[model samples]
Target chain A: MQSRVDATRCLSCRKGYASHAAGTCKECYEESNHKILDLETKVAFLQFSSSLDPSSSPCFSDVVLVASHDATDQTDLAPPVPIHAHKAVLANRSPVFRAMLENQMEEALSGTIKISDVSHDVLRAFVNYLYTAEACLDVKMARDLLEMAEKYQVEHLKAYCEKLIISKLNPGNPLNSFLSCVLASKHKAKNLLDAALSLIVDNMDKFVELEEYEELKKDHPQLVFEIYEAYHAKQVETAALKEKK
Target chain B: MQSRVDATRCLSCRKGYASHAAGTCKECYEESNHKILDLETKVAFLQFSSSLDPSSSPCFSDVVLVASHDATDQTDLAPPVPIHAHKAVLANRSPVFRAMLENQMEEALSGTIKISDVSHDVLRAFVNYLYTAEACLDVKMARDLLEMAEKYQVEHLKAYCEKLIISKLNPGNPLNSFLSCVLASKHKAKNLLDAALSLIVDNMDKFVELEEYEELKKDHPQLVFEIYEAYHAKQVETAALKEKK
Candidate 1:
């Protein structure tokens, strides 16, 4: 009878109810309910958002896959699942990015990305690229991305695209490559002015025309006059050499 | 006689002259001539440039001083003295930059920068700030310069100014305290884009706007959506609390 009583006490202790509770432990129940409530809140938001916005289904699928696949892959600012759930939360949410991504993928598959030919898919891929940035990318794709981003009023995407282009503008790329980059950054995306000009300096000789020179002056007035003087000196020297010859 | 010859040799060595020749050797003559030639070049350029473009006369003077100082100093591509001579050399060849500089400066000092009340001097200062390319600068001057650079077409200057602003966006400077350094970078300069956004994630709520959110969506769709969602969730929670109250 004493042994039976001791066993009963031990069972109650194991159950965490003998010391302070009659049967159910208050702390344990609270913790369990708290977890359930948290899960339910998240699930309800996801379901409500999904039902409200069908256009975000693709993004939602991506989010869901990300959430279920690996809990460790949460480097992005967004939660890894049901991507459209965010759209429901944010006001004036637009599906512009969806188009950007698709366009980028299409352009990648194709050879070049004509600025005029930009579409929704390209925009979506561009958005994805910005979200999940990479260290290395194709130069051609980078250029296309820049042109598209600049056109679409996507400031962040344009900046990213410019950076990639600047990096690829090694000494090996011809001087002509920087002309567009310089113009674009100078006018539309002011942030790339330094990097673009720094690259252009290597090919200063290529800017021959008064028109081209004037354009550079308009963009970077301080640099143009300086370049013109140097060019004139070189011209004079060449003329003298020709006369001697 | 031998001692006399030895003394002559020592004097020749001091003057960078070949000992084989008698008083005032060839090396000394050449060195002296080169120094004179350098001085002459600077003076001629200064005079010609000043007479041709009086507006940039100060720049010319600065260049002459830097060139005449020392070759070693010329090589130092940092703050000490403005390397205006290198710029002068380039300007001598390119007329466009000269015209642009003259026009920009004229516009700035004349107070004709804004469409309504914007001062052109601010714009000119901003362009000059970029042209000078100094790593550090005066705070008040920097803000003024940034505002002007943005006003004019000196986008690169604006970008650099934005970078400087972000770096110094501490709470101490009440006049220019940043609510969100990242948003400031994105809004102020073109190149800052997604890269700047990633750095100031914690402060996104304090500064990001509805228009900016939409803009970010197209370029950095992932960041835009994520930040928007997080921001909205917080708002929702706050609203819920109010309801409870």
Candidate 2:
């Protein structure tokens, strides 16, 4: 009989592992491979070549998204960006856009959908996500996009932005953490909300000392109450768990 | 220490096996599960709600597809079916459709893209596939769609059709098997070619006796040679493998 050394060869991993190592046998490997192939092909079939190119408009795009701030700006940052896109695509992704475009509204008739209170860069990224379902995210970009996503009711983009915001949350930036909690509450994001509440509860002493904490108490007094309520609930739950143990 | 039985639970399959049985040890299973979720979300993101309904033509559809034969038909079998769709959707899927629509040709100007030499049902299904990356396929439907897919240069659909055609290959239908080999060669479908060649080689005597064999030899002498050549090559390879063993 072959020893543990020979038994180490994993069909899936295609590497030698310990005899009790984490890997599938040939059957499971083959099954998963078939599944992966099917899914990859489906993804390929579903994917569209992004129709966001401005100079060469694909012509079929029925509507335009122009950044309100960029339209007024004379500086060479970026000109009044009239981002060409399909109303069908916008409508399909966001119910807000759908209601705006589908009911013979002014937006539909005018063919110029004005997105105010956002920079051209954020607006471009937002429109691109409507077609491609992808975005490059940083903390600031994620927060801006999360607000945009929440406004549009694009649950997918909101979730993607929330994930990025949650991943970036740390003790170094308690203000950002608190803001994330506010966004999580606004978007009703359970995962981000939990992470945010946990961060605030764990570092309660330093959390109140932050600059935004003072402003949040004044601007959003209800949020300050929520933080305490969440902290108390967690303490009670932990005490109950300790008693059972 | 856990016994072999206790250590046998598959995280994916959720069934216990012997310790030496086919499955991953937790880690690979979890990795694949995460991959599956990501892929499923991506697929969901890419999928479109077909904008094909006629009652409330949202007026966004730039072009339409009409069954050419149905338009010409005098009988009341069905009305001249004008399948409404978007030029962007058509172009996104097929280069042929893209070229015809994007070039401002007669079809583009007329806003009516006529699909000739296909039935109303087939044309409807084809347009539906352009919107949703899905189709209901039987053997006849698979063959018809494969031909359309090849014509349109939709590689994913062609591969899907080729897989279906190859899977249905059997000794009982030597002519169909031979035909699949011809399709495989024309389409450069390696998997279908090997499958078709094996079916022909495995039932060589019956293949020669079939009526289509005489027709194939008359119509395509080179294809007959290819079938024999493939059989000979497989025999040599099998002999070499046996010798190595």
Candidate 3:
């Protein structure tokens, strides 16, 4: 038995494993490797060059998007800069843009779309994503983009942002997780909400010790109740499993 | 050893492999599964809604392409129909289009580009491929698209067509393989050229018996010479290997 086990070799890592530690047969493993390669090739073929890059040449932009800032917001004194884009790209990426452009809306006739309450950088990134399906995201950028993606009904971008935020959720940081929970709920990001909820439920005692917990209980009592409900359900499930054992 | 081999169950198929037929350790298999999922998600995200689809709402097309027909070649009497598209998409996909549109060439200024010696269906497919890196390819369609892709410098589409053509290459059918070799050489499709050459070399005796071989020798003697050179090199390598044994 020991000799047979020793003779076994993992095709992936080229190492010996115990019989119980086997993952796949040779045929299945090779099939999976081929699947990965095919998928990677498809991804490379599908990825487009961004029209926003100046070096791409002849963007032939037919529409402009200006981030309309409030007069009272004294962030910058300069006039709002317009981002050049193609109506076709914008329409293809977002249903909101399609409606705005296709139905002879005021923005369509004017060839200038004034987007209210969004910063220049966020709007630029949003448009770039429509062109290339790519963005360099941080926490703030992800949150901002998530909101814009939700408003535009760009499901791909929204899911991308949700994945990023969910990956960043930490059970060790209760306050951050709580805030993410709030943001997810607001944006209707179900996956992000679930991840944040799981983190909070796992560390409920630490979460309640934070000063923000009292404020959250007072201000958004429904959200606090929901978290407690999830914790209760988890406890009940664990108790039932223990009883069965 | 028999009992231990039976104990080693594949995680994927849940079947036991002989000790030497083990593929991957549990950790590497799980990692590969995750990587495949990640790549699949990325491919989904990157794939855009093609502007050619009318149901996708507004296309906002800015340029038109008409497949020009030669008067001498009477395939169809219908006037050349125009395909609407975005200049930005065309330029982003093909450097040839970028140069033509960016340099304010005759086609760029006219808002209409005339493509000569291409069927309407082939031209439409080519334009659609620029927007969505996909095509339904048969032997004739693949050959036509490969020529266009090579002419327009669309490397992705070229590779796609080459892969399709190479997949259809058969050593059992020497005539088809010979034709594919000729086409690959004409288009400079390196992968297709290599695959077709390999098929032809493997069945050199069968290929020499074909009627097309005489015409090819008389017309493109250089290509025929290249095939003989490859066959000679392969024979030398085989002889050397046998001597070493």
Output the number of the lDDT-best candidate: 3
List where candidate 3 sits over 4 angstroms from the true fold: A1-19, A25-31, A51-58, A70-76, B1-21, B50-58, B70-77
lDDT of 2 by residue, B98-179 (tens): 8988898999999998877787777777777776777888878877777778788888888888888887888888988888
Best to worst by TM-score, what's the order? 3, 2, 1
Model 2 is docked with a DockQ of 0.49
Off by over 4 Å in 1: A1-116, A119-121, A130-136, A182-187, A206-245, B1-245
Clashing pairs in 3: A11-B23
Screening candidate 2 with a backbone cut-off below 3 angstroms (N, C-alpha, C), the clashing residue pairs are none
> Could you tell me the TM-score of chain B in model 3?
0.87
Sort order, DockQ high to low:
3, 2, 1
Q: Kindly list the per-residue Cα lDDT of model 3 for residues A1-245, writing each as its tens digit.
A: 23564556778888777766778888889999998988777776665565564334436889989888833354557777788888877877788998998898999999999988888889988988876667899989999999999999999899889989888888789889888888888989999989998999999999899977779899878778889999999999999999999
For the predicted complex of model 1, DockQ is 0.01
Model 1: per-residue Cα lDDT over A87-164, one tens digit each: 111101122433433344553234223333544334445434332222244666666677756555544456566766
Could you tell me the lDDT of residue A124 within candidate 3? 87
> Rank by lDDT, descending?
3, 2, 1
Task: Please give the interface root mean square deviation for model 3, in Å.
Answer: 2.6
lDDT of each: 0.40, 0.78, 0.83
Model 1 lDDT tens row, B72-109: 43455642222222222223222433343345454223
Instruction: Please tell me which model should have the higher lDDT, number 1 or number 3.
Output: 3
Query: Considering lDDT, which of the candidate structures 1 and 2 is the better prediction for this target?
Result: 2
Give the distance in Å from residue A65's predicted Cα in candidate 2 to where it truly belongs. 1.0
| First chain TM-score, candidate 3 | 0.86
